[model samples]
Target: MVPEAQLRDDGAGLAPASAGWFVLNARDARWFHRPGRGDSVPLTGCDELEAETYFPMLGMSIQVLPPGEPNATYHWETEQEDFLVLAGRALLVVEGQGRQLEQWDFVHCPPETRHAFVGVGDEPCVILAASSRQFQKDGPWGFYCADEIARRYNASAPEDTQDGDVAYGRFPPSRPTRYRDGLLPD
Candidate 1:
């Protein structure tokens, strides 16, 4: 095993820094430079990418669209994305057209495009996706799920909150949805 002291690079904090600053380029240069088939990157969380990148130019992010799973349709703020499929198969449904994608396939997506990624295999559809710009200031991240789709994802947001504070339900000891018969006398 190489000593930690031996691996430090020019003190650019080459050392494995904190959670926010650690560089994930820890593998071989040749391997990454010339990746072969099935080089799926492991799924990472928001905390890791939050440090170096965010909205407006959100750093590169990789999302693996599982079998039969679809990425929530959304848009971004003038940001572009590069996607590379590693394993299985998938399709980029753009403007109602289905484009077949195989391993090692690259797809470029421009900003503000109403697009969605659909898994095309019975197996996990692996993909290595990246973006040129990071996330925008606030967000271009909004889901386009209708009432029917909401039930499919099993998600719900408060439609109306009157008589009680929204934070009341946000706090740890938040109260459950209280029903007032007078409010909805239907």
Candidate 2:
């Protein structure tokens, strides 16, 4: 049966029901804000979707990063992850190597491929990131790594660890936020 779509906003932002199926512009999707790191919108409507109704196989989101800001600590997951640069420029640090990416560049990280991204250039870098979730929790889902290159961008874990709290200890907790005009490049 198709789950009915609904809307919710608990002073955070509007998260339209996405179970079964739902349609909404990215600008109307629920977003989150991390201090220093830019805003992000989980395209799957994860904010309001019930746990039992969550997508069983995949997770997706769009990350907006300001210049010199990194999307996350350098890490690798048990599941494959993929990304597409939608706008602006970004520096991709993968497997201890650095690569410059531009609009439309695509990246596919096989399971356990260490990687992270930092925004570059004058404008905010936008990336569409997606990952598989099935079997992710069957074992350790992720492992943060310590790398000199990632460290240069402040995106490396202080030391190797599988604990998320320890790996992300330096960053502030993210808060739910609403989308605003000009957040995305036209």
Clash statistics: count for each candidate:
10, 0
Task: Estimate the TM-score for candidate 1.
Answer: 0.48
Worst 10 residues of 1 by lDDT: 28-37
> Which candidate leads the pack in lDDT?
2
Q: Write the per-residue lDDT of candidate 1 for residues 22-114, one digit (tens) a residue.
A: 344423111111011122222222333533432224444344455555543322225676788767687666543567788888888777543
Tell me the deviation in Å of residue 13 in model 1: 21
| Error of model 1, residue 41, in angstroms | 7.3
- CA lDDT of 131 in candidate 2? 87
Instruction: Report lDDT per candidate.
Output: 0.41, 0.86
User: What is the Å distance of residue 127 in model 2 from its true position?
Assistant: 0.2
Model 1 misplacement above 4 A: 1-49, 52-58, 74-77, 138-186
lDDT of 1 at 105: 88
Q: Model 2 has how many clashing residue pairs?
A: 0
Error of 2 at 118 (Å): 0.2
Predicted candidate 2 versus true structure: per-residue lDDT over 1-186, tens digit per residue: 887777666576666554556666788777889776788988654532452265657878999999999999999999989999999999999999999999999999999999999999999999999988876658778799999999999899999999889988998998888897887888
Where's the lowest-lDDT run of ten residues in candidate 2? 44-53
